[model samples]
Target: MSETPAASVSRRRLLARSGAVGAGIAFSGALTEVFAGTAAARGLGDRGYGPLVPDPNGLLDLPKGFRYRVLSREGDPLRSGEGRVPSNHDGMAAFGGRHGRVHLVRNHENRPTAAIRVPPVEGLTYDPAGAGGCTALTLDADGAVRSERVAIAGTAVNCAGGPTPWGTWLTCEETEDKAGTNGYTKDHGFVFETDPVDPRRTGAVPLTAMGRFQHEAIAVDPRSGAVYETEDAFQRPFGLFYRFLPDRPLGGTGSLRAGGRLQAMRVPGLPDLSSVQEPGARFGGVEWVDVPDPLAAGTPIRLQDFGPRGITHAQKLEGCYWGGRSVYFVSSYARSAEGSAADHFGQIWRYDPAGRWLTLVVVFGPDTGVQLPGESPDNICLAPSGGLMVCEDGGGAQHVYGVTRRGEVYALARNRQNPGTEEEPEWGEFAGVTFSPDGSTMYVNCYTPGTTFAVTGPWAGQPGR
Candidate 1:
């Protein structure tokens, strides 16, 4: 497969199509009301193809005209004869394939003791002892699974990753474990590239230059080939947003392994992103500090002192994607109760690499209640219909929320499977949200039981399509 650029579009057009302009509104602008107010009062009645109807089979709830097909599930036999499918599906990416098919590279956030692990394929296994890796699934033109196989193996806590312009998935290890910890034979927190089309091209080698830390997700700039990554650290000192400038920008497959420079973002006086409570807060002239120790052999990258200019950090730094010539990242949530500087339900930030400025695009109020329409946004991807599809990792129920340019938020899909008893229902968080290259199908993963679904519906009728 060749390089596949992100779904880039004109910002002005995208905003206009979504009805964000001329109204002094931005994406997710009405999020507060959408959650706090009633459905009819919030104008969601005619939005998002109507409210999601409960699924009869107790799997996934979708709009009246929308239906989902189970692509793969945990414990399922692989077509490649590589044992059963792994668990803890997280981030993923979709690429175009021949004969109207779509190729998906999914992450398995498993540990060393996972019951079912990505089979350690000979050359693809980085460390046979590691249980977390990635699997590639090919879907036919009709959205049926054509083939399934292990793309990479022997990695730990493969949480989330981004797609490269060269049509490959960058699987990130959300860990800082050393070789001695948990029986790991090698240091495991690094980014590895996987080719969905040709596994042979991906040697399962770690991209050491990308830094070793708790990586959540990454988004690659098609223009500069610069990769923006998020760190999902929950403890004190939190996580830092990083940018990797590759030596060979846009150099197709296996180029990131060549080398790169890693740097952390610093906003003059702002240290923790959670402190910013209001939307449209813009910070200009932001600076990047070089990471002295990308390998983190002694100290983690976020903990390393940058001298006089301390590195900026945020709590629960998650989803990231490159679109509209800017890199968008998310801060899932922060709380004073958790040692964070401030509190907020969620925040979506836009960073303009060209201008070296950052803006708080969307900020969800401090609503801890599970009734919020959208909360704890993770694994975000730009919707083909001019907005965004956010995977919810919050409490209560789990949903894939869709945000239009008009800032209307609606539940696109809800998890109907309750792992807990009927009296105490539990819904798994949705992750790895992505649309097919043709924009006909939306692929998302349920993290707990590790189920992947391909949703098809009246996408063209979407508000901003």
Candidate 2:
């Protein structure tokens, strides 16, 4: 287990994605209140995680049962052409249409910045394009979005992915350019695979060892198609954390172009352990260090010497999900690597591949005595009862935080979905969270008005299970 190579991928152009997933999906909304639930702001239901409640930035104290509306924001007018949906939305996936319909596929982290550039829309993936990236709505089943596609075009900052069991939507590319020092002609970090429901064949193909850098969430073991990534890695400390394997196996979904094995995440010993509250031995508690050899031909092994011990609660570990078998994600950033700032906070670990281990359950510290009125906690999923939704990019108190499975922490909705006056919730704020295999309905997406929302009520347990 050993690895390192934070970004500068494109060993010479490789990753590729195709299209297929069109049976029908059209759910649009503008609702206000439905079978909602409330917990009176963190009651936590004795940890059964019941008393359910979310969607109450309603008045702004936002925490009780939870309630929210505004299905598709941003310039509005979704049919894919005109007005909005080009914001900064990130990570999504819902597919499963025809009658029991719902197809979402979204991700748009857009960050070229210049008074808000991103505007070249239309089945994106660079080709005379420049827009903010990611977009593919096509909801239905009480959510209504009929059609809207830009699957993955002209990508650069399009982040978050992992959703392909033959279904589509892999869109990642946390942007890291060095085209001669960064004018970024192309060769953006990698990972692109889409097909929301036809958008002229959403073009983009690049998975290249899955290293690159900055790629926020991705968890697709699918029983060994292998992929477990997360890296905001922030500040050039070189930002690392990954694992991608697929020379061909669980049928990882239509050709990424046979290029697998990339690893990083070492904690094995400690170069003198420098405070993450002095953690240097808890390493591999959540075990998954395999950067060795990757077919490079043996010996390589380093993968952070086997993670966890201090300095790993997400230097920016954006978001992740695989569901209870083990993967359970979260952690927006509590700092480490010298700047320091982590006395045990922002956590949710839970990794358990048949006893490999990594359980922290819920420990975002200032003291689970609990005090998160502000920020920290980017993307996490698994709620219906086992509780935990996190997502508070926290600005003017940006929320989406929910915790259960026996550790209550409420504050469900209030992203407002960015019509953008910026006063608050310049965007709905919830980034890269998905549900709807049968969780009834509760789809949220927003990184910058790159919208996608569908929240129905009476949510039963086992979300994302």
Candidate 3:
């Protein structure tokens, strides 16, 4: 399925308002100053709600008048009696439920060696040997957990996934571990669909057509039912951004299992996304190359041959979300010292499916300074107020940032809880960062020690909205 000519025309008009095509396209002033590749963009300044106030509880630090509550912890027993909560909480999505409640499906990026595993549930277990999976949480109107259960079990490294327009979660496994590599099991590294409302509807099946690799996150286009995915491979060959066109478009539940065609993105003249340094640099005539072997029986998709014009690849393609008729994906830093083509802290790209155009919306200059607002944005989501909420996965200190449409950056929350000593403080990276349908509360996760938080404040009164 493809977008209509009217949609393409609409996108062209939007681009005209932002800036014309190519290397000097000005964005909505949402990233101009912050991504100017200057020393000032690397410094910490007041931009969002205000300066973050330190939390006395030694957990999450937030701005004045804003507060967060711990909804789930690593060792807590699930209300559904599905065993203790798993560790290494990662990607997540929120949905509206009965009686104004919120339903959240969260991924557990667990390796086989992790102490606590997502308890295998009947009919929902994919492989008994795999330890990583997903858990669904039901919260009441006041943002308190009412019930929690295992949504999908026996998957490996369930890193991140996207919520479907049909009200389900596409959980992704971030591993290529073979059956015998770890233990008794099956081949991992595939996408699995989970139903937040009913576990029986999930069926614990893997969407093989989505391709097998170091899958990170995905964003689905509601109009065309196209799935855009990201791969978080950190090796020499790196990862390729993928698009999956399902046989069934917008078919409600259990439709992905019917099969689909998978393809990797190819930018005409660019091979590596990190090679481009200028903000607002746009690449036109984008193409998609079919992946011959979606199952990856022999070679990984990124290392496969896509004719003489090879597919484009990036170092760490992390967060992805759909908004304003475009697919926004992130590359969480690259370095020449680390064998990359060039160096940069982070990059946020906007892909217009209608026009087949890719634009660099934000780029964090590689200065190695921890104070930068755009430092290593991992999981991202579009706010109701036309801003971007960024979860930082970088060093020194961790924070959840809010970038206004005018390009101003502000600290919404900071991770004050460190698991290590002061000399070697290890603050876990913030993941998830989603909001309720009513736009009232924001939800996020701490990757290490496994904790979920519900934040509520004067979101309506927040400045720069």
lDDT at residue 175 of model 3 (Cα atoms):
84
Model 2 stretches astray by more than 4 angstroms: 1-90, 93-100, 108-123, 127-150, 160-173, 176-183, 186-233, 236-335, 343-378, 381-386, 390-402, 405-432, 441-465
lDDT tens string, model 2, 350-392? 4556665544444453222223343456666655543556565
TM-score of decoy 1: 0.89
Q: After superposition, how far is residue 24 of candidate 1 from its true place, in Å?
A: 23
Residue 353 alpha-carbon offset, candidate 3, angstroms: 1.3
Cα lDDT over the full model 2: 0.51
Tell me the TM-score of model 2: 0.31
Model 3: per-residue Cα lDDT over 123-231, one tens digit each: 9999999899999999998788989999999999998899999999999998888789889478999999999989778778989889989899999999999999999
**What digit string (tens of lDDT, one per residue) describes model 1 on residues 1-465?**
000112112322332453432222114443332222222222223366676788889999988888899999999899999899998888899999999989999999988767688889899999878999999999888888889999999999898899888899999999999998999899989999999998779878999999999998998989898999899885789999999999999999978988989999999899999999877788999998899999999999989989886989998898887766678888887767567898666788888899998988887543223333445677887665555688977555778987665565667888988878889776788999999997778999998788999998877664423
Instruction: Give all candidates' CA lDDT scores.
Output: 0.81, 0.51, 0.81
In terms of lDDT, the poorest run of 10 residues in model 2 is: 11-20
Query: TM-scores for all candidates?
Result: 0.89, 0.31, 0.89
Clashes of 1: 0
